[model samples]
Target: MSKQRPNLYYTELDLFILLSKIGLRRKLKPSERRVLVKVYYSEYATPVVPVLITNGKIRLCGDYKLTLNNNLIVDEHSLSTSEELFNGLAEGDKFTKIDLRNAYLNWKVRDEDQHLLTFNTHKGHYNSTRLMFDLNGPPAKWQRKIENILKGIPGVYYL
Candidate 1:
């Protein structure tokens, strides 16, 4: 019997093509996270949380559960249930699905709060200017904000 493994590496062209595929869908600000190539002595950087590309979509994620998620406070805002969304829909209403690529990172972190998100890596120390995934607070915060935004609109709904 013979065993074979699929190639799990990506070339630069692959990355360029991947980015091109979803670039328009995610025409986000280039200033998502500042590339801090060096660390200051006074800055307290968290343990290294490497950039994770989950799939072909080039969906980047952060794994701060071990390093940062613990000390942070979780927002207690209630998230909407499937039942609630269905109940709110009327006969004449239509559903519009929007896909946000860099989901949590759409929200920028505050200047003061950005310091807490600093991470140390072999390459260099870095900090996030925008919200990163695996952070405890964004989902609830975003849900609350979405609810508030849709609340004022006449026919818009969020899922």
Candidate 2:
């Protein structure tokens, strides 16, 4: 990472390579149509402690002071509320909970919007072909998709 600017970092080269290997991002080649956009980093407090895996050794993550203004709404889809979720449970209800790991990443970003989601690193500019975390629209989009799929199923209610 760069010392001058917390957001500006050289680690993007390695991060981008890892992401590409995991099919989350791709390197923009000369022949492909490029959508050049600037990416900003933001810091937020999370319940989970941050850790970094460097050279196969785990260590406490460094603190950075870069804030990006997402200007996005939370829970824009008006999905289930806490009360609704609780009410769905009965005293003797036998229910199964499914946690879709990396649910957001599973959704592909539209081709047109890929350019706007491009990020620049020391190596090169890359685009997120799939949805990334902290985006306001992803939750709602995912909720809608799930609702549509679960609709008209036998005794399947999305609470």
Candidate 3:
């Protein structure tokens, strides 16, 4: 019988690519960015160690276990939407569509409830908890805002 073993060695770039592939990538705060890069470089041969420390987890394939809450927020596009809602079909109408850049990022999740956005890694688990939106139930204010917008539409509309 013959026995074979797999090689687990990795290069610096390999670690970077691995982290990126699993969605473990993050846009660090201005100050944290420098530190993060240094941490990655300083521990190049064993980047995973620092990665687990800095990110507080060892994610695999970038899949994070997201726990949805009742106070969830979601993009309008994610909801059941109709093209006619914003389509300017009237004759001689100048249609204008504005995209909200990084709209979800503009939202702030309360510090107390940030733990909802966490992931389990190969080593342990970590989370930012600062959710930009909810995927489950929604806030009352958001529901009212949508309802108000729909009610205020001057023409016939259906969702």
Candidate 4:
């Protein structure tokens, strides 16, 4: 009988691709070239967390509650309620659902704020150029960004 192996390694190429998609770039300032965050991995769920190699150990990065409490600003805006969602649809109206894969990664973190999300590894130090998953403020930030974009569009209303 042959045994199947579960993949354990999250290669550097994977990190590179994610960073590329997130538009990550190197900070040229020597003073800024310090590890601001540490990467870690988790297998507590079905899909294993992304792993990064650092000093021969796996590390994961994310602290939602802490990030939210310290870094993000709360807004007055609220998500649509069930009633409001249903009210938006009328008879004969077509409903469409759009799923944006890696939606959080699509949004970029401001250069000034990027340092807040910096992380370090055996390889080097880097900062996030885009919003990362499990960050504290991404949901609110995403809502704000979408709302802003919708404001500029014609015939689009957000409640």
Top-TM-score candidate index: 1
Q: Residue 18 of candidate 3: its Cα lDDT?
A: 66
Residue 107 in model 2: shift from native, Å? 1.4
User: What's the residue-level lDDT of 27 in candidate 2?
Assistant: 48
- Supply the TM-score for candidate 1: 0.63
Per-residue alpha-carbon lDDT of candidate 1 for residues 69-94, written as tens digits (9 for 90 to 100): 66666888866678867776765356
Q: What is the TM-score of each candidate against the true structure?
A: 0.63, 0.50, 0.38, 0.48
| Model 2 agreement with the true structure over 38-74: per-residue lDDT tens digits | 2353222211112435666322221222211133334
Off by over 4 Å in 1: 1-38, 49-54, 57-62, 100-103
| Clash count, predicted structure 3 | 7
In candidate 3, the residue pairs with backbone N, CA or C atoms under 3 Å apart (3 or more residues apart, or in different chains) clash, namely: 22-62, 58-121, 58-122, 72-134, 73-133, 73-134, 114-129
The 0-to-1 C-alpha lDDT of every candidate, in the order given, reads 0.55, 0.46, 0.37, 0.48
Per-candidate count of clashing residue pairs (backbone under 3 Å)? 0, 0, 7, 9
Compute the lDDT for candidate 4. Answer: 0.48
- Deviation from native of the Cα of residue 135 in model 2, angstroms: 1.7
Pairs that collide, model 2? none
Candidate 4 vs. truth: CA RMSD? 13.5
**Top of the candidates by lDDT:** 1
